[model samples]
Target: MGRRGDYKHFLPLQTRWADNDIYGHVNNVAYYGYFDTVVNEFLISQQVLDIHNGPVIGLVVETGCKYFAPLEFPQKLEGALRVAHIGNSSVRYELAIFKAGDDAPAAEGHFIHVYVDRDARKPVPLPQQFRKVLETILV
Candidate 1:
């Protein structure tokens, strides 16, 4: 489980009606989308990632999540992000989804992204600027 204090960056998430399944809760796959959003949002805001034109990009090689509570539409939500590890060519990003104002996360997860050359699709050392931005939230 993750607590509010554990993350250094946060983004307000809007729950959509379509996100709910027949179970009346946000579907399991939707949580992964939230996780991706937070990480990319951080990178974009920092001007560290160029989705279409950059020479380098990150490829997700590993990911997992644990659900602690149900999340339904029509509720305020937030996504929290932190860097758990930084290797020469990979970074482990830990993320959590919380009901707004809640102390504990409704769900938590992590994904490892290996930086790679976009053209060759080969692993590459992280750019100094990108690594510096990641270090800001390292824990």
Candidate 2:
């Protein structure tokens, strides 16, 4: 359902041998991990999220995925991301997985992360840094 250029940000990820299932394809669950890794890597690299010390942390409250093709190990997976929606306390990240040399996404998904207080566990306004980074991908 998505094309290669649909997303603004891209992260190339190496598929581990352990990621493949008996059928020799990357398991369904691995796709979600790739999504989370790419998003967090971007946040950390941008100095927007500090997993250990930030006052606000994102909690994954919702997730969904669709597979269009099977990905085998040894193939590089490119995770593509864009902001579909952003609210005061939550942001919806749309993502797609493109296998190396593939013209379109082999898998597509999204997850909503609610920014909450690390101590109180209550939703909080999006941190200024968070908004700034997210805006780069917001469509």
TM-score, every prediction = 0.98, 0.97
Off by over 4 Å in 1: none
lDDT of 1 by residue, 34-129 (tens): 999999999989999999899999999999999999999988899999999999999999999999999999999999999999999999999999
Clashes of 1: 0
List the global CA lDDT of all models.
0.96, 0.91
lDDT tens readout by residue for model 2, 17-91: 999999999999999999999889888988989999989999999999999998988998899899999999999
What lDDT score goes with residue 45 in model 2?
86
* Count of backbone collisions within predicted model 2: 0
Give the poorly placed runs of model 2, Cα more than 4 Å off.
none
Error of 1 at 15 (Å): 0.9
- Candidate whose TM-score is highest: 1
Worst 10 residues of 2 by lDDT: 97-106
